[model samples]
Target: MAQFPPVPDTLNYIFCNTPADFHNAVWVLRHHPYLILDCEGHDLGRAGGCVTLVCVGTPLAEHIFLFDVISPHLSRYDIDALLNLFNDRNILKVVWDGRMDYLELWSTYGVSLENVLDLQVAEVVSRGVVRGEGEIQRMKRLQQSYISTQVSDRLGARLDGLHAVIGLQRCWKECGFPAGNGKDPAVVKMHKSIGSRMWVERPLTEQLLQYAAKDILLIGILYAQFSKQGWIPRLPSDYYYLLGQCQRYVSAHREQGKSAAVDAFKPCQIMPLDVLDHPVGPKYRCNACHRYLSLATYETVQGVAPRQASTSEVPRITTLRRPRCRLCQILALRAGFRMDQTYLVT
Candidate 1:
């Protein structure tokens, strides 16, 4: 069996359900400058689905509180106190992929998560950064690890795909953490088998609770490691750029109908915006993805037009363009169906 990242046994995990428990949890949680956050639910962030668990871990994974918002014993006030932490800019909420969590929080409780740092975005952005290693060598290793050479031979083709979002488990392994007892294969296998029911099923088993705790633990550890290596963006401009990206991710789901699923895996889904923000040729809207993408994202052909003829008597040059971005084009080829090109221009 493959090794799993070790979670320390000494990790303090509290399942807060009753009023007193929630009150105590909130008091302790608010004291932290930053908290690692994760959520589990049945079809969470979607119509007909609801958030079942909210996991918050202190820095260094000292104490992890599993807040049971669905518990009848906990009043709205207790839940609100905990959610106030989400709105507090003074307390940072470090998350892996927080899109659904943000959307569900707003749609269900009217809370807008503030001071968020999405680690998934940080990981994608880190591919472009080289700390101690030589730039060329570091990029090569990153490409080998995270990107598919078949995608494109272009340098850093990995940056172009929203599919590059790395899951927390893979991120944990990549960070070089050792296998621990909490990562026992049986426990993991059981958790996956539970699927959506894992969160909604009352009286969550110890194995499931530990699984939830592991997520926040991983988030906290990743933030610490990324911070030490300077992977998390800290400059005012870069910071806001990331914040905007996180907000955009959440907003993508806001207007979505209850049954409508946000297809995160679609090639046309948004990638980190900064990667495509380069100053280059004017962007053209992809007929498939409907996103304004740079020239590099499409297939181009040169053509001569009599109307565009230059004053020097050269035929006016024009480029025949493809209807879709390269990524979406490939997807259409494999999927054997094309999405409607109709989209309102923003």
Candidate 2:
């Protein structure tokens, strides 16, 4: 793909192979100003693995640019030279779930991850896909999408559902990936005709690569989906601004003593264990949290370890009323004692 004509600020691609080529891509990338990274690599071992393929583009408008490059399956040290380029530099991308991606980059190449955005984080943060909508919905949705249906109509099976989103999502960190699952018999049949290919073995199918590229850009699409009314932008600048705003909101919300309500009443330590296995009658100790009956009741274990503080809803301490001492009560009862004055109680 080439630079999108409509949006000049939108980047096209950053293709690199050799260290020189990597440097070149960095050069080309600087001119474009904005880029989205989609990496592909081989499975060598737990640590010294993953060689990148072409880097793609997602313009804010709707065009894509692709850069084609290859890695000769070099040693980890050699790969480190190239990986350093990814270090600390702000780049836009939506890693499906980037925890392992972050770890792998650090573990293998010592790449300092800076402004990379995990789409999975965005997905969970925005809750874009919805709870328990599950893989089947994505498959069904992909089946109907322009990408999915076009592949299906052209090749007799909607390969994007099987290859890009569903198939590739399964590759979470093993070899290196975001992550996915299988579907029903009909769904199974639909995928069989599509067939899965090892991108490592050969250049990925143009369709697969396109689908993969598009899937990466889908974060931008979804971000736009939300940003129409001040939701969020898929780009790094917007995300940083949003992060700052969220931090302020959280600080103010915190100052309002929102989390201070967790200190109302504490259970006696001995009480939870006493009811141990009993499930009937006064079934108080939630087998889960081991802390009296709370919403965080752990069923099989104390699940509320790190999570105990927030879920406990510590109450804010406001005004304290003093209990009346014998003298204060006595004075109040006297014939001439004024009831209006404040008295110290022991």
Candidate 3:
């Protein structure tokens, strides 16, 4: 019987920590709309979130850039000069597992990772809760190993999709994944990630950038899974609206005296469920209703306090009185606003 190799359960692609590697990544990112990003820090508790290399690019594009920390031999302002080059541009950002990045970057540099789309949330909402490497893809990978061990055990059978099995290949040119899992775990040809997610962050090494770059490039393609045309994905208006809601959510957080308010623009701070233990969660309040809401849930939504009417029609919002604005008094009463709902509206 011919023997096959083992499937890796724990495989981490190490990054290159060199200045030359970083410069190349930056050059590549100047192109492409959607990309994948990630970062690693020393976990210094409310600090230590300095970026090592910021990778950017799309699928099929080569020459990935890697912006690394200035060499010890260079001057102090060298890093600052590189940082200033990427200030405010019309670039779409994506990040996976972003919460820690939110706090760490602030403590390290005044700069926070902002304007990011959360693929982790998308994966959870679309594929259901998955922890660690416990994804259908992971199981499929196990299937390969299972067959190797049980070659005589009814062929064991191999199942693969959503995630791909690759040794060293760019996202653009690799053999894509299949679609679906479960009893319906049939093959659906894919060009990128199974669920189609995006990433945006720094890479650690020259070789690692290749993996990171491919990950983002594939994400850009998979996102189109919901679109009619492969090149143009169908994005709901609410998508952008949700981003605005996040802006308000973060701004409101800042007004509450939480230090990270301005930093709300960071990738990790964009969504609620991503906030496993939100410090601001305890302070969440509904303007229409006095009920306290967990910050984690509140961050996931926008508009006035969420209403839950058992009936068909949504109860109109009531405004509060006693120096309360009509919007709050009239709207508050009809909608049921309380002192908890009342606050200084700027």
Candidate 4:
């Protein structure tokens, strides 16, 4: 069996599960100007799961502090101190893909993160996107163009292919960290299988602890390299404002039902005409057939829409609005209609 490589002796791994230990960890972290933050939780994608472990690491000290949030180790004082540290604008908290982390922190401890430098956002900005194309050009299109420009050679050609933890791993390897030998494939496989269940594990194994520790440690290292390269930029105010909007949207969806939430947050785009909006009720103009037909003539097909919130109370219903009429949908299914030639009824 392949064993995971041991953590270097130069780095410190401090596990804090007691009140005193938690306080000491906070004290150590308080002095750091910048810290890389990450949280591990069960069913993290779901809104209900609370954070299990919080890892804070700094590249300068090469120290990682793991706080066991699920255990009875931390008191309210300790929690408050940790929250304060995150809220301090002077002490920047570095995170990657922080939307879920933000939601989890708010849901669990009612803490709002301040002075957050999301590396994912930084990566996007660093790559540089073309602008002023017009409203028709979507964000995805701009990102694709940006990725194409960054591709120079086969080796480091596709930064867009990297994402999440895997992206961080790639950055570390590029920064001269030991690559394949540092992590065992078997251990990585085990981590993936049991990662979502980390919160429920009564006593976390040494392997799991090491896996979690490496996450934030790599973030700190990558941030240092990115900073030195001058890839990090001062983000615009609008960026943070949009993030706040998403945070509020997620929070509201968790409270009010999904349907109610969508109704409240109407998206900014061309509104589709419902069956009732048709001059002849329950009738639609089919782009494929180029004929007005009754509602019964068309089948309701799935369309591009906002994502529904995951909740038991909500019926997981999708909004019935669609771009193409039923006859067009049926023709497409039969492989008889070409979507490129079709036109919206408008």
Candidate 5:
């Protein structure tokens, strides 16, 4: 028989379904200022799908608690406390690729996730990758780059398509955390095959429980490493702002399912107008929508453009040109207005 490591005693894997267990988990979480969050849901494509499990991992306590939101044993108070944690601004909630999690949480709980720090978003901003480069900037790639320095290219490439934390377990192991108690490659492949159906399984197996706990545990470790590397400070201010906007956009889309609103929520960058002025090219791409447009699409501000001298005797004069596109400006204004309304209502 192949020998495997024992589950670490330091990791408290609490499954909260009863009031006592739920309250105990909440109490432990209240003391921690930061938490790594991940959600598991079923029927993801339909409106009926809801957040089934919420995993909260605290690095300080070295504990990961799994909350059974759909379990019949849970009471309204237990659910309310869990939702309150998501809304708490004092506790920084860290997630990797939180778009679907945010949407599902809003759809199921009618609560907004506040003070969120997305590791995937931070990774993109740190790399300074151009927008629309989704194929390259994936969570597994980020994990391999930042956490698992020893992973081979072939294995890392294979893990790119997987959406689970099992892909990053090696990274956690390298970081000295016991992450792969039940996450062998064969087991991970089995779990991935089931996809969203894991939520429907009753009397959750120990392997599944370990898998859920490890997701947030790895997130917590990656967050610490990111902070140590000073990547957190290097992230642009708009990234944080965009996270909130994204949550709102998800909420709005879930409620209304409008394409226009979702499109408006697309990530955008505001660069200085001078960066857009290329002598060789007349067309420029909008930093927000990533759309290439003519000069007419942009709104001109009174700014100095480089002037060419006609002759040796002629002196150069500065000219004005449109710096920012009009569509982005409109979208920004609308987003701000919507944010203001959300604040007032909240």
Candidate 6:
């Protein structure tokens, strides 16, 4: 029921905590072909964590609605209507790194998001991972010449290996979005100072709420940009493939409990389908990614052991093994997961 002054940006936002506001929000949201989505909370996507605010922005950042889930202002019927909107297959939902948001929504409120396009996934897929030294150099030069210098640094570092996930803030900057308070260094510092605790605080600071709104606004802009640049897939098969990756990303941590560390290694995001499903050859199933990939996808490693089975009491000595694919190995290594290796087969 509390209303704050409009954020100093073009988008208009409403804090929808009361039942009447929620009703109007759902009605307006249903008319859009796609909605920009993001969520804010304290340690969300983990057990004991909660989603405090769900930011939904209309296309082109016209209007943003802050659905306050922390407040018990809406009835079950109102909640169900919003849930239906999320689950609707006809309507698209644009997001940036929506894994945690998806987990929190489903785990906390039983709301499963469908028909989603994650821009983070799109960004990674746009520049498919390459391994050869010549290819890496060529790609780096190409990106630097076409995109901004910062983007070259942002993306070039991972050309020889798996893709590193880009944060939404940097992603916004990389896309050449207009400068505003949202991208201000001082505001970013203030957000870091507040950290995860601010979302749980009742009557959140107007600045913090505005910060949340601006995130979805950027997401909308990124969606439009990616679409216009043909970064998003247009073909039916390619589009569905991207969508499947987005779904896989959200489901990766479904069984994981609350932990202090965010899992930086998502197989789908690290090595997208575009990178994995090519150069058709004899296939072997990877123990980690669980995909039947070509032999080139793997690296020969010696003295590597598979995860030990709990039921067996006898110790199984580590042996030369090639359990996971190359991309999975890179992901595990970057995430500080322990691995034993010999060398790349090729």
Task: Estimate TM-scores for all models.
Answer: 0.70, 0.40, 0.40, 0.56, 0.56, 0.70
Better of 1 and 4 by TM-score: 1
Candidate 2 is scored at a TM of 0.40
Those runs of model 1 whose alpha carbons end farther than 4 Å from true positions after fitting are 1-6, 131-163, 179-184, 234-237, 257-334, 339-346
Write one digit per residue (lDDT tens) for candidate 6, span 206-264.
77777888888677767877877678878999889888877765554554433344544
lDDT of candidate 1 at residue 309, scale 0 to 100: 40
Question: Between 2 and 4, whose lDDT is larger?
Answer: 4
- lDDT of every predicted structure (CA atoms): 0.68, 0.36, 0.35, 0.54, 0.57, 0.67
Q: Residue 102 of model 1: what lDDT? A: 82
Clashing pairs in 5: none
Please give, for residues 3-66, the per-residue lDDT of candidate 3 as tens digits: 2122222223323345544444444554566444544323312221244444444432233333
Cα displacement (angstroms), candidate 5, residue 118, comes to 0.7
Measured over all alpha carbons after superposition, the RMSD of each candidate to the real structure, in angstroms, is 6.5, 21.3, 16.1, 14.0, 13.3, 8.3
Worst 10 residues of 1 by lDDT: 265-274
| Top candidate by lDDT | 1
lDDT of 4 by residue, 1-346 (tens): 2122344633458888888878888888887778888888775535345678888887543778888876776678877777778767678778765645666776677777667776654543344332233322333442343223232222131122221122455445645667753444555686578657655586887876777777776676567656665556436664454344323322322321112112312111111122112234555554443445454434343444444467445343332423444323422433434433323222
Candidate 4 Cα misplacement greater than 4 A, ranges: 1-11, 129-166, 170-178, 181-184, 234-346
Superior candidate under TM-score, 3 versus 6:
6
Clashing pairs in 1: 6-179, 6-180, 308-316, 309-316
lDDT of 5 by residue, 1-346 (tens): 2222245534558888887888888888888878888987674424456677889888632888999888898778778887899889788888865656776776666777778877654544444333344644454453444324333242343333222222246544544555445245554787568656777677787767777776776677677765665546545665455455334323323433212324553422222122212223466565454545455445433433333566455443333333334434544554543211110000
Q: For model 3, where is the 10-residue window of minimal lDDT?
A: 180-189
What TM-score number comes out for model 3?
0.40
Could you give the candidate ranking by lDDT, starting with the highest?
A: 1, 6, 5, 4, 2, 3
